[model samples]
Target: MGQTIIEKILSSHSGQEARAGDIVVAELDYVMGQDGTAPLAIRAFADLGGKDVFDRERVAFVIDHSAPSPNEGVSALHKLMREFSREKGFKLYDIGEGVCHQLLPESGEVGPGSLVIGADSHTCTYGALNAFSTGVGSTDLAGGLISGKMWFKVPGTIKFVCNGVLPPGVYSKDLILYLIGRVTADGATYMAVEFTGEAIGALSQEARFTISNMAIEMGAKAGLMEADDKTFAWLRRFTSRKFTPVTADPDAVYTRVLECDAAKLEPQVARPHRVDNVVPVSGAAGKPVQQAVIGTCTNGRLEDLRIAAGILGGRKIHRDVRLIVAPSSRRVFLDAMAEGIIQTLVEAGAVMVTPGCGPCVGTHNGVPSDGETVISTANRNFKGRMGNSNAEIYLASPATVAASAVTGKITDPREFI
Candidate 1:
């Protein structure tokens, strides 16, 4: 009769006992929408005759997907979002502010035990903070904006207990990719994946973000972790918000439990057109690459930049490879500059773009050419994901992408490490 983390959080918000498959109307702590979807939500809100948002403080809009106005049509949408935010007093994150997922956590808007809804599928990224966050459509976002509450069918939890220390050159990204490959893309549809065990605990908060951000690829409703000292430490640097971390009871029922060992795991790569078509680095080595990207919502943090810089230091990227670095946030950009990480990457032949979802969503920047092969630290490898259906994308960890950039092929990071 024990409740899982999602069940417990829903129970608190709904003021009733919650269980798997139970529909409950729960209060939301925060809600967000980004450029790709917010415009629709804004229009939908008007369609619903929405005059004032339930709370300005709890709602946020970010312009990151097609930042700096990729085209006139997008520019007009940006204007609409700006005009609305200005009139309604909701927070608007302009160009260079960062992706919604990164900005919310950095500004302390997200915390443990909070129920959050975002209009972006990758909104599950906040689950690293021990919160239950999920994505919704534009219409649903409009509803939450007006009422500050949403109904949910509590999802069953799937516990993934990772064990052992991650081997050299292998990281949290590799572990998650390996899992997704085994479980397939649609394996965990509508389920909450609770990550636990020794290897997961050994990961940094940034690494955990990379893991949780990709949970949607596996069809997970949310990817969650238990808050510990590392989570609290990261929160302290951002906000003074008081949060009581939520954890599943010892006897909480799980739909399934998977045990994984990362002791001998090598770097993983999800091949083109499908995130589940993954293989070890050795299987895809020497595949020519025209471009390599080191930043996105999944791997654009400071730690990822430093790892790329460390690998590229004292060397230049291959003549055939174009490496792009997109910082996730302005804060991360400024901090990296102060530490000379930016300079090192630029000097090593990496091109730096604005801090946003550059090249990931294929809205504008860093789009690959026809027949081009790109190795990126992005979450998905679906065809046309980077603006061209002809170009192929291979997903890997930051280290793997950096090393591959140096050699102009799919190379393992362990060689440089």
Candidate 2:
């Protein structure tokens, strides 16, 4: 019996043959905590009487969730994190650096075959680099900080093989939304998802990151793509880290195998209150929107920004719509600025915000009022996710968001492209 990618990674880290359901304590390559969770983790570490972290260089604290201090409470938390980081010698990414998931990889802390964990649920975003990453609670992160290790019950694998070229205006976001709709939220609970096939190979690094970042929405334990030339090339641009790419064996066991043709996929949208409540763009078109947000860890990469800029160039957002554009990282923001994407978006009536989580976490920036409808590129669309239970959030690709912003309605991106 050959091992899947997750199995192989775990086996290597645990020094034993790993399989689904096997509980083992594996050494972690990296551990991270965001502002929303780091305080709890720090308290837990103190309660455990921790004098020093096992590996200060391997731990990080990212201040993004309530960046710029939404209030005094959050500002105090940021101060606490900064003080702790200085004391422990752990890396700290301050506000405006970007979301943890986006900045972590950009900093070269993540790579193939690494075991990474974060206090944020979207930690699975690193799986796009073929790393075995997942989210843990504050206490778990505290434990990892102390021991540089964490326990895991290996998960079964679900293989998604996507082939064929994607049609114009359809993107990785659409493919993920379609899959989540098919599986329904919680359908793949705690299962490892491995994406493969020609279409995945053809996707840019940004698209791959977008796909892996949203696996949690479908209840996946970890969403991964086999590392290839593209993955290595992207990593090279960030760091000189030496990594041996890991791939599932040809005969690796899988709980299920799904085949998809990307050419047939359409732009997908997740309606209010539920990520699985997805529909084709055409089916949801003509619905009015009051706001549109074009950025997040899920789809706020440079490629996503360019896509939105292309759609909005030479056109202004509808008078009734308020559009917000937030790049995922400072590096992305600079690159976009150099390319004039930021200028184009701003000229088209989009408000450019800091390179952080922005409206995605609803902690600050771009929260909608009651009865408003918002189209966003963020991952989740649960009720009240954007700070107000009465305001509805619709999740879509950046292109779709830009198009809808231009029309003040739910418009198909294909119409604009």
Candidate 3:
């Protein structure tokens, strides 16, 4: 009986053989919290009588969501996080740095086969490196901070084998949106999803990050891709730390197997209020859009910005559409600027905001007005997700958003590409 990737990682951390449905206490390599959750975690840690973290170096706090202090209240929260990090001697990433998920990988805090837990649900984004990363509530994070160990009920793995070549203008976002639509958002609840096959292997590390970043939309515990040469190559660019890539055994059991024909996939869009309410872009084309965003942890990588810039180059956005662009990290922002991607977007009538999660959570930048329609590259389009319950939010790839920004409607990216 071979073990799945999750099983193997858990077993290695637990120092014993393990399987799905088994609760095991495993040592964690990293623990993190952001401004929205760190204060709660700090409070919980103090309540546990934890005078000090088990490993100060392994803990991190990032002030990202609503960064640059949306209000005095958020500023107070930032102050609290700063005070806590100072008191605990842990690492802290402050405003203008970027979203926690993107910054962590950029900082080389995430690696293959490590167990990482963060207070943000999107912490699962690190699974792109084959790490066993998951999101937890503040209480669980507090416990991990105090003891350096956490309990996990190992989850069954769902294998998604993506074969064939991706068609023109199609992206990992479109592929994941298609999967989420088929899986119906909560279909993979409490399970691990491991992407495999030639398409997965061929994806850039950033593209893999996009796919794994959205796995939470399907209610997955973790979304992972097997670490391979490309993974190592990407990691090398950031850190010289050697990581032993973790792979599923040849006969590892899966709850179920799904096959995706990447060549046949089309541009997809998630309609207002539900990620699973996805349809081909054609279904939503010609619908008016007053706003379009081309950035988020889900699609705000350098490649994503390049794709949007390529489509928007030399073309102005529609007069009716307000286009906002945010780079996922300061590093990505600088790289984009060096490559002229930012200037191209700005020249194309897009508003470039800070590197932090601009307009994604509706906290600070680019919030839509009542009854307006927005096409965005960000994940989640639930009612009130963008700080306005009356606004309609549609989710699409960066290229789709870029094309639509020019046309002021839901336009298929293929037409522009």
Instruction: Order the candidates by lDDT, highest first.
Output: 1, 2, 3
- Per-residue lDDT of model 2, residues 144-187, tens digit only: 99999999999999999998978989999999999899988998
lDDT of 1 by residue, 1-417 (tens): 898999999999999999999999999999899998999999999998899999999999999988988899999999999998899898999998887889989989798999999999999999999999999999999999999999999999999999998987899899999999989999899999999999989999999999999999999999999999999999999999899999999999999999999897999999999999999999999999999998889999999999998899988999999999999999999999998999999999999888999899898778899999999999999999999999999999999999999999999999998
Which model is ahead, 1 or 3, in terms of lDDT?
1
lDDT string for model 3 (145-174, tens) is: 999999999999999999987788999999
- With a 3 Å backbone cut-off (N, CA, C), the pairs that clash in candidate 2 are none
The per-model lDDT (C-alpha) reads: 0.94, 0.93, 0.92
Please name the candidate that would achieve the greatest lDDT relative to the true structure.
1
Which residue ranges in model 2 land beyond 4 Å of their true spot? none
Candidate 2: Cα lDDT at 408: 93
Q: Which pairs of residues collide in candidate 3? A: none
Candidate 2: worst-modelled 10 consecutive residues by lDDT: 48-57
Clash count per candidate: 0, 0, 0
Q: After superposing candidate 1, which stretches have Cα over 4 Å from the reference?
A: none
TM-score of each: 0.99, 0.99, 0.99
Residue 183 displacement in candidate 1 (angstroms)? 0.7
